[model samples]
Target: MFKVIFRVTTEVRNTAGLREIKRAGFIPFMAKREGEEEVYEALYKSNDLEELREAITEAAYFLNKVNRKGGNNFATIYKVNDNYVGKGLGGLLGASLGLKLGGIPGLFIGAIGGLLLGEILDVELNETFVGVYSWPISIEQ
Candidate 1:
């Protein structure tokens, strides 16, 4: 399976937009809101790009139909190589363990060893696509 990272800005706020994203097969993991600007980060899992596209299209349609007035402004999608996250997590864990087992020196040594092991174990060739929105949702009512 492949993982996709989707980011979008829309007038739809909070739980409302989250529901639509979930319906599109994306799990909303992170979100940031600054005044009127809301950016959402989500992860979508699919067998291939085609399937992911279909799901995205469906999401767009749903958003357009529901919001109508406040539609998507900008959207981006990327195929993610999730190994880096694992590597970082592993390194932190290793560093903590090392510190407990030894001390400051052990922390550095363990972190390096853990990071290397994480990199070796997690490698992926994922493509990235930017601004693939074919039909931008209307922001005007």
Candidate 2:
């Protein structure tokens, strides 16, 4: 599991511009405010950085194309990681729930599921990156 933070300017905020990003198989995990800019984090499950890079390239290309064709869009990306506490706490909660519901088998299944969820949450909590491109264009209506 790898994390990628796609930072774009809030000057052009619209979900329609994200079509290309979603088409590229990136999952929008969270969004935050950084001073006067808006930042968005996305998740990607790739075997390595090379694979993630290819998808990111394609996504950037798509965004550029959209912008050239009268769309107000610009974005930059970065790689990030998940924290430890999220993984541990998620597993603990899952195990507790499983134990209350069933026996050992339930505990195992619950722990695994919880751990995965927790790892994802950790990524959302620990994303920090500087945006490369910032566009202040307006959407063509």
lDDT of each: 0.62, 0.64
Q: Which stretches of candidate 2 lie over 4 Å from their true place?
A: 33-37, 68-91, 94-117, 121-141
Q: Tell me each candidate's TM-score.
A: 0.55, 0.51
lDDT of 1 by residue, 34-111 (tens): 565555666665547777777777766665565522334345666566658758977998899899998999999889
The clash count for each model shown is: 0, 0
lDDT of 2 by residue, 1-141 (tens): 555556544345556446766778888767665653445567776647667667766766665555422212344545456468998999999999998898898899999999989988787677665334333333322
Best by lDDT: 2
> What's the lDDT of the predicted structure labeled candidate 2?
0.64
Q: Give candidate 1 misplaced runs (Cα > 4 Å).
A: 1-13, 68-73, 82-131, 136-141
Provide the lowest-lDDT 10-residue window in model 1.
66-75
Clashing pairs in 1: none
